[model samples]
Target: MPLKSPITVVATSLLAAQALAVSVHNWWDVPSDFGNIAELQSSIRVPQGSDPIKTYWMANGFGNGYMGMQHNSDTERRILFSIWDDGQGSKVEPIRHGDNVTVGTFGGEGEGAQSYLVYDWKAGDTVYFRVQANVNEAEDYAEYTGYWGTDGQTWNLIASFRAEKQPYWLLEPYGFLENYGSDQSEIREGYYGNFVMINSNGQHHTPENFQFTHTDIFNEYREVWDQRLVEQGKEVYMRIDGPADQGAYPPAHH
Candidate 1:
């Protein structure tokens, strides 16, 4: 069984608090020329001061679902994987799941199945995430598998879900950071890099340039950290919350 994670995750928690917090999101897209992709792998490192409670640092997100790590309640940090319904009337079903992991249905943020492992993923440590699609044309569904680990090569199988109207590839891969806690001025940052995409035809692409996006919150709050572009758009830097408008070096810079 490949259910064990290469990096051991000890359970830990943060004192959860609530009030008012801004949700900041960013995206990275692969070159359109590469075309339909079957798998997308990336890493995220929420630096020392960047990781906060009630934060979700999404690494690999597609048209249907997303897989990443989250800072849940005071006693639980998780490696989470969630997927919404097929939208054409078929709900996503869990075909397989890892050990000591929770798998079930989730509502509110679109109805779907969700899974997570209570692993104490520390801030400043890099965690890698990957999502691969296995399409069954005859069945008219695809089994999408989620994996996470410290090293890019070894991965722990988070869960596998069957999504209806599932395509042959993971369409529109992206990454975003979200803070769900109530802290209006706390700095939340995530460095998303080391992007590797494999197309349906078995072509590999190492994408470096990532474009930035600002949500509607930026229009309302107008926080300086919400302003993303750092140096000539070579790196995609996203900071949500705080008054200072400063930039940092890209962790994925090679």
Candidate 2:
């Protein structure tokens, strides 16, 4: 079945008052590998600012088992990476030491090599590093695919490729469905809306703008659900909220 057209809904209460700046790009583009080694590095010369800087990296596991980082150090000579084996899952955290920390090979099966890392800055800091790799096998594409979180533990969705085209992809926060409990009768009686759409561009338009073009898209989608409900002698209602505040992710380094 066609996946439900992806939708992003944000709660008003969670919106932030200030706008944040974010810039993303791929730093490494190479053939996926099983044993061949590669290094992805970047340097952001820290400028003067009070914002904390945060860096993130992840492997997409295309032709390789997974992506891992090694030998990470800041100008301050601090060990940002750590190696640990939790028995349940063995991987590096913060940063890993030793020249021998090896990431497993993906055995050349599905997506070749995919991974990514991001650096969040407060305002004027420069950071740089080389993400090195050790590969044994190789594939065609090695685009980065991963997400980072405010805390190391919980992560939000960052980006992913479209199923077939593979050329088209999207980047946004993870979405969720709001469940209105057992009151089936209440489904249509009061305010009943299934989804919310957020335009990251922050451009708000009236119903007329939507009626001419963008508006028709949602109307069509709503019609589909309405038809199904009507067939069952049920009632369904949908409401489109404003270009509500789409909260920004925490700055990478603040």
Reference-based lDDT, residue 199, model 2: 27
Model 2 misplacement above 4 A: 1-37, 53-79, 82-127, 136-254
**How well is each residue in 159-240 modelled by candidate 2, as lDDT tens digits?**
3221221211121121111111221111111111111111223322111110000012222221211101112222111211
TM-scores vs. true structure, each candidate:
0.81, 0.21
Clashes of 2: 46
User: Candidate 1, residues 1-254: lDDT per residue as tens digits?
Assistant: 12221011100001110123344445555776987678888888787877768888888877677899988877889999987765335678898988888999976455678999999999889899999988676766778899999988899999999877554457666777766655646567877767888987889997665655444433434344442544442334566654454335322211
Per TM-score, the best of the predicted structures is: 1
Worst 10 residues of 2 by lDDT: 206-215
lDDT of 2: 0.20
Judged by lDDT, which candidate is best? 1
lDDT of every predicted structure (CA atoms): 0.69, 0.20
TM-score, candidate 2, is 0.21
